[model samples]
Target chain A: MTEKKKTTIVLFSGDYDKAMAAYIIANGAAAYDHEVTIFHTFWGLNALRKDQQVPVKKGFLEKMFGKMMPRGADKMGISKMNFAGMGPKMIKHVINKHNAMTLPQLIDMAQELEVNLVACTMTMDLLGLQQEELLEKIEYAGVAAYLGEAEDGNVNLFI
Target chain B: MTEKKKTTIVLFSGDYDKAMAAYIIANGAAAYDHEVTIFHTFWGLNALRKDQQVPVKKGFLEKMFGKMMPRGADKMGISKMNFAGMGPKMIKHVINKHNAMTLPQLIDMAQELEVNLVACTMTMDLLGLQQEELLEKIEYAGVAAYLGEAEDGNVNLFI
Candidate 1:
């Protein structure tokens, strides 16, 4: 007999495409009748903002460092896959390409599918972001809270 | 003129769909002309294995624990995602659906497109997997080595 599967997705990528990927995967799991939870932290929190992501240019030193450094988030933050200028565009394309859902869709899907959504308080503090600044229906918690959820025998994923 | 992008991808999910997402994104980046790297570790290493993955069952105690648990990879080992039973099937579906490239195809694209593939040594140690056991193109490195790549800037990701 088929047993139930519980999966948790941790989003660390603040990048649009990566976040989209997480959202899509979570949505897929929900479609498959799996319990899903998403923990957003760090740059990942940027996706939770109710506005467009403002590109921040590094200062002279940072720019120089960035010049010598890697240029994309996947490489810098999660995995080193440069989305180039196409990161955001490709995200929209694939989502459209697959008729895949959006962040809001994923969020609503999370609720309808009973997926848990948790925002990292520590990350919020670091970013000077308030819980109220996030979209409605998000649960605010700390790393400890996330770890507690991760302790369950299901599956945990970092996106 | 658009500047060049250096990117890297860290893959921890061995599940087929998640791995396909990484590859899809990598292919997209390569199409856009960027340097890419993928560091696979833990369950992510399962993608590199020649044999199929063995399904894991939760014992009675594990089942009870699952009831109270968050259901994720942290409890399983390191940071990874449990892709449900559909993982392998979904991977095959998506790949076939897209006429998506094989791991070798993706690797070749990375090579032709200058994508670097690295395997995490720490995870290899914990999992008792050997370097020789992986695909020929894979390069093994310690976390520090990955950090070195990240420290130099470019892009770093943990997926």
Candidate 2:
């Protein structure tokens, strides 16, 4: 019998679509019956946080003022695009329309599917996010810890 | 009137989920009238290539072997974890399941969306892929080219 492949997805984009992609992929891996693990790092850490606030970016002039300010992921949120101001509402509509899960739904699916979810410690520190602020189910680890997981998998995705 | 936000997505992962995420985001961004660009580098380039081929590691042993193979995101195709026996089918399944388009479809979406699709020249050279081998619509540029775009945007995503 052929052996099952081990896969790990390292998510770095905190944006909605990117996070949704990670969630979908993790769900796909689980469907295939592979042991899947997701590691959230840097900006990717934002989505895993329990606070889940939107990110805010400075205006063009504000960006020009100096070093620029940190943009929170929650504020810049994924624009639903064609739905006009209805991107978020439409997203929820479409996901439900297609029976596809939402980001939060995907997150729930990850648990039901038993995918390992880990948040990067370094990013958490850089962002000043406390462990208590992230989803309680997520495991916190350093870069080395993530590398250890990567070392074991044949598939590693930086999303 | 508020100045429009121009966004660039730096795609580095070639996994099914990541690819799906980039596409969904691009499609969403286009719907919103945002100027969007996607720069494909490293493993991300694979999904864009005409000949899309990725090796699936079978088991623990194969994964260990994969890790020892190389650390860089060079020509060695991105690894798909535990693909087991169904490689081509799996790829198709993902594409169809998500109503996701192919590399060709993705390119078309970018064009229709006016999303600047760039192929990293350095990565192309490393992988022995000439400009001709890539989708006809893509622009080939170096890292500096992509950085220039990112420097100006209020939004940047590494997916």
Candidate 3:
């Protein structure tokens, strides 16, 4: 038997459209029976945040950054045409009309499909995101861990 | 003799930061003797625009889009923290201070280093961009062209 095919995606964008693209690709790859891994770092970490507060501890700057950033995929702004948040609201309306999954729902689907979600520990540290502030049931690792998986993967993507 | 490792980057963002990342990765791969192709599409096509106005005929919507969109790498705004375009200006100042190459300069270096640059034909057709409006010496192709190159590529990224 041949070795299992793998696809690893490094998600580095916090923009709604970009995060949607990454999840769409990840879901598609998983459907094709590929071992999929999504490594979230920096702004991408915002996707893993819970919409409701989790009561985590943070310094002044960290709290400021956390408050300024969108809480979850649902709150993400479009990279362009944001129009002070109207773009995302319009996008959500469109998605609802099309009966398509929201970013948060896609994240759920990815989990149900067993896609490996890896959080970048270094970024979490830098951004002051604690484990309590993020969604549970995800892997926490560094760039080396991602590189090791990427080395032998048949397909590696950085988004 | 060793097989050539191929890397294909699908540049899909118009933001300065994303464009910078794509070119930096392409240059790095080229430095490592890897065959690199940057398939620029949609918003990413902004990076390929010439600084000077090319005076191409366009439809009303296309003309409006052309007028609204930033021209060339130097005019691109940051994906975030744009703050009415001050973010990119600050970034430019920082790059200048570090003596780092600007986006336009990076594009020139990519050309000199022999990195294959392909603009998406469909996007151009949809956006009403003519060949005369863009820089010379780059390939214009469709998704099939990108897929053909990506099929054999060990690393394929959608940025």
Candidate 4:
């Protein structure tokens, strides 16, 4: 039997458009029958955060970070032409107009396609995010785990 | 003889810090005897712009884009905490204090180490950048060329 082709993506940006691109690529790879993994790191973790607030213990800096960052993918802003949150609204409008999926819907589709969604543990700790605050069934790991998957990956992207 | 590992990077950000990360990885891969290529696209093309202004004919929108974007790596802003350009100054200060190489110097070293630097031709046209406005001795190609290099690469990243 042939081994599966691997596609590993390191999602490092928190921007809504960038996250959408990452998920779009991840879902596409999964659809092509590749073993796909999306490792969420740094601000990218915000995409995995639950929409509602979760009660959790944290230090001053962590709490400050939590308060400062968008709670979920829906709250994240676009990377360009943000125009004080207007860009995201406009993008959502376009998505709806074209019958394209939003970032949240893309994430759901990625899950449905059985794409591996991993949160970088070190960054999550630094950002003061706990497991309870993220979506269910996602894996937690570090750079080493990412390197392991990417070293043998057919498509390794740091987005 | 065994083949050398390959690393391909898609640089899509205009931020100084992100560009630095991309160059650092590219330099590291070259040092390790890997075939490395950095394909600069979209806003990332700003990093390749000549610091001096080149008189080039352009349409109204292209001229506006040229006026708005940074002229070169030295003029680019940080991804976060840009505080009216103070952040880049602080970063340059810290880089000096730590005896680290600056972005321009890193690019110079990448060239010295024979790391391939490619500017995406499609984006260059879209952004109104001519070959004369970019650095000398670099390549220009589109997404197909990037995919060709990346499909067999060991470490592929988009930043």
RMSD of each: 20.1, 20.5, 5.9, 5.9
DockQ of 2: 0.05
Error of 4 at B111 (Å): 14
The estimated TM-scores of all candidates read 0.43, 0.45, 0.63, 0.63
Candidate 3 wrongly placed segments (more than 4 Å): B1-6, B15-42, B45-151
Worst 10 residues of 2 chain B by lDDT: B72-81
- How many clashing pairs per prediction, in order? 35, 11, 0, 0
The true-versus-predicted C-alpha distance at residue B77 of model 2, in Å, is 29
**Local accuracy of candidate 2 as per-residue lDDT tens digits, B83-120:** 35343344444445445455446657777888888899
Query: What docking tier does model 3 reach?
Result: incorrect
Off by over 4 Å in 1: A1-4, A52-86, B1-158
Candidate 3 residue lDDT tens string, B12-77 = 899898899999999989999889999987678889998889987776656755776678888988
Better of 2 and 3 by lDDT: 3
lDDT of 3 at A71: 95
What residue pairs are clashing in model 4?
Answer: none
> Candidate 4 at A104: error in angstroms?
1.4
TM-score of chain A, cand. 1: 0.69
Quick one: best DockQ, which candidate? 4
Candidates' chain B TM-scores in the order shown? 0.65, 0.70, 0.96, 0.98
The regions of model 2 sitting more than 4 angstroms off are: A1-4, A51-76, A79-84, B1-159
Across A96-137, the per-residue lDDT of candidate 1 in tens digits comes to: 544546555655666687777788988766655655556668
